[model samples]
Target: MELFGQSGNFVLINIVSGNIDFDLRDDNPAPCENIWVGNSSTAPTDGECI
Candidate 1:
């Protein structure tokens, strides 16, 4: 686990919502989602995003 990093793509579990989250898309950096929903592959971040 890395979170909200400047590079790399990976998924981590969000225990609060019981979903997986990612901070990279298409190999680019993205806002790390601490809370998410939906499938792990396409998990979507919801309220209180960071």
Candidate 2:
């Protein structure tokens, strides 16, 4: 379980809606969603879809 990201502000939401919730602290980076959505080679990020 590992996510790579730079230091900044981000908003996490459940795309399906009302199924999941996410909150990432400034000290803790978020995992890239690329593993679940895009191809395994793309390396998705929390900011990609936005």
Candidate 3:
């Protein structure tokens, strides 16, 4: 489905691992900053964005 945020737009799909794979795009594309997304049950320890 289409996902919109303050950063940009994205398309997310479900994966076998019960995780979402998102393809993000932006008008002014640049390196993503501190973005992290994952299942709440298993989050990043270092606060690093995936």
Candidate 4:
């Protein structure tokens, strides 16, 4: 997942909360932008990527 001018590459696992956490990576790279990933059940108030 490569976002424009942003690195969205990473694996998500053992996620217990809606916070951002990555367990593996090629390097401790800079985080991606404040992007948003929402579903149909997602609310607008929950803002930012979760």
Q: Each prediction's Cα lDDT score?
A: 0.36, 0.31, 0.31, 0.33
The number of the candidate with the highest lDDT is: 1
Q: Estimate each model's TM-score.
A: 0.17, 0.16, 0.18, 0.17
Clash tally, candidates in order: 0, 0, 1, 0
Return the top candidate by TM-score.
3
lDDT of 2 at 41: 20
Residue pairs whose backbone atoms clash in candidate 3: 35-49
How do the residues 1-50 of candidate 4 rate in per-residue lDDT, one tens digit apiece? 33344444333432333334432212323454433333232212231233
- For model 4, give the 10-residue run with minimal summed lDDT: 39-48
lDDT of 1 at 25: 29
Q: lDDT at 15 for candidate 4?
A: 30
By lDDT, the better pick of 1 and 3 is 1
- lDDT (Cα, tens digit) per residue for candidate 1, span 1-50: 33344333333453433346643223233454332333233455332323
Pull out the clashing pairs in model 4: none
Q: Which stretches of candidate 3 lie over 4 Å from their true place?
A: 1-5, 8-28, 39-50
